[model samples]
Target: MTNLALLGARLLIGALLIGGAVQKALSPGDAGGMLVGLGLPFALVWPALIYDALAGLALWLGVAVRPVALSAAAYCALTSFFHLNVFQATGDAWQMTIFVKNWAIAGGCLALMVAGSGAWALRADRP
Candidate 1:
């Protein structure tokens, strides 16, 4: 049951990341603009798309989960900052929701990192 739960968590997180990458890819202009608006280099979007897809895939396959989860957690926490200013008087409520959601996802990633992929994985990191 524990292993199943872990697998489910991995699948959910992985799918979310992959889907996010796809969404960003679909509107790279918007993504780049958002980054630029936040004073970040537009080029950052390219690497973000690649990293999200690869890291999500790794998580889905249960490969190097601890390291990947750690990175994903960090990624989520860091990216959440980009949405931090979405609570202004005229800011979109959805953006704020996404911001909080990122932190929640980060917490889940941290838990997965410590749990070490449970008992089911392509190559189990532990017995």
Candidate 2:
């Protein structure tokens, strides 16, 4: 039961990251626009996609979960902080929602970092 819960958590986090990467890949213009609008470099699109996808893969594959989760947590926190303008935009609640989601996802990543890989993982612990 415990391991199942952990696996489920991993899947959820992994899927979210991978799905985000896929979306960004499919719409580079939009992703680039958002990055630039947030005062971030547009070139960050590829790095964000690559890092998110890689960390997401680690979550799914249960490899170096602690480090991966920690990195992902930092990513989420950074994105969340920079996207604060979402809350200021008039008549736009969706941005705020996304910001909140980032915090939640960051919390989840922190939890995963502390939990370690439970079971059915490729690399449950450090060598």
Instruction: Return the top candidate by lDDT.
Output: 1
Task: Write candidate 1's Cα lDDT for 1-127 as tens digits.
Answer: 9899999999999999998799889988877877888778999999999999998999899999999999999999988877775445338888789889999999999999988787688866684
What clash count goes with each model? 0, 0
**What tens digits encode model 2's per-residue C-alpha lDDT throughout 15-75?**
9999989988999777788778777889999998998789889999999999999999999
Predict model 2's lDDT versus the native: 0.85
Candidate No. with top TM-score? 1
- Look at candidate 1 and give me any clashing residue pairs: none
TM-score of each: 0.93, 0.92
